[model samples]
Target: MDFDNFKTLGEWDKWKGALAKAVDLGEAIGFNENTVDKMAYRIGNFLSSTVDPENREERVLQELWKVADESDKKVLAKLIVRMVEKDSRLH
Candidate 1:
């Protein structure tokens, strides 16, 4: 899928739902949490570099991505993964 399309998706909920579906698919495919989280970071890097932030939260993440060193970027990625997991549970 063209990850860049996410920028034009318009709504934050659409972005969140798409990400949740991806997470569900990864789990269904037997990818462990660690691998999924690693991939999430790579995806995050791609988005941060290629796509303009589509919302306030995404803009904040973009700002953080711009300033973060390599190690901290990994942390940010993990945090995002965890947030997605928590959100899925809540809804």
Candidate 2:
């Protein structure tokens, strides 16, 4: 995926779609849920540190990330993975 293009788009649906794609790709590559969740946590940390929030949802997540401890961040990342997975299953 072209992350630069995605950053420019800044739409919540696009963000969610990208996340769903990541989840799908992880599954396709035989990553277990734990592995996927860990990857998500790393990605979340990277984004929170390096990327500015472009929308309200992202801003909210950024805020949450700022206050969350390490374990809480992991839970948040897992929740994100689960959210996209469930959404993918529905569609």
Taking all chains together, each candidate's TM-score versus the true structure is 0.83, 0.86
Which lDDT tens digits does candidate 1 get at residues 1-91? 9765575555776677778888889989999999998998999899999999867778999999989998999999989877777778888
lDDT of every model, 2 decimals = 0.85, 0.89
Candidate 2 wrong stretches, greater than 4 Å: 1-10
Question: In candidate 2, what residue range of length 10 has the lowest lDDT sum?
Answer: 1-10
Model 2, 1-91: lDDT tens digits are 7786565555877788889999999989999989999999999999999999987788899999989999999999999998888878887
- What are the RMSDs of all candidates, in order? 6.6, 6.0
The residue pairs found clashing in candidate 2 are: none
Question: Model 1 Cα displacement at 73 (Å)?
Answer: 0.8
lDDT of 2 at 9: 54
Candidate 2: clashing residue pairs, number: 0
* Backbone clash tally (model 1): 0
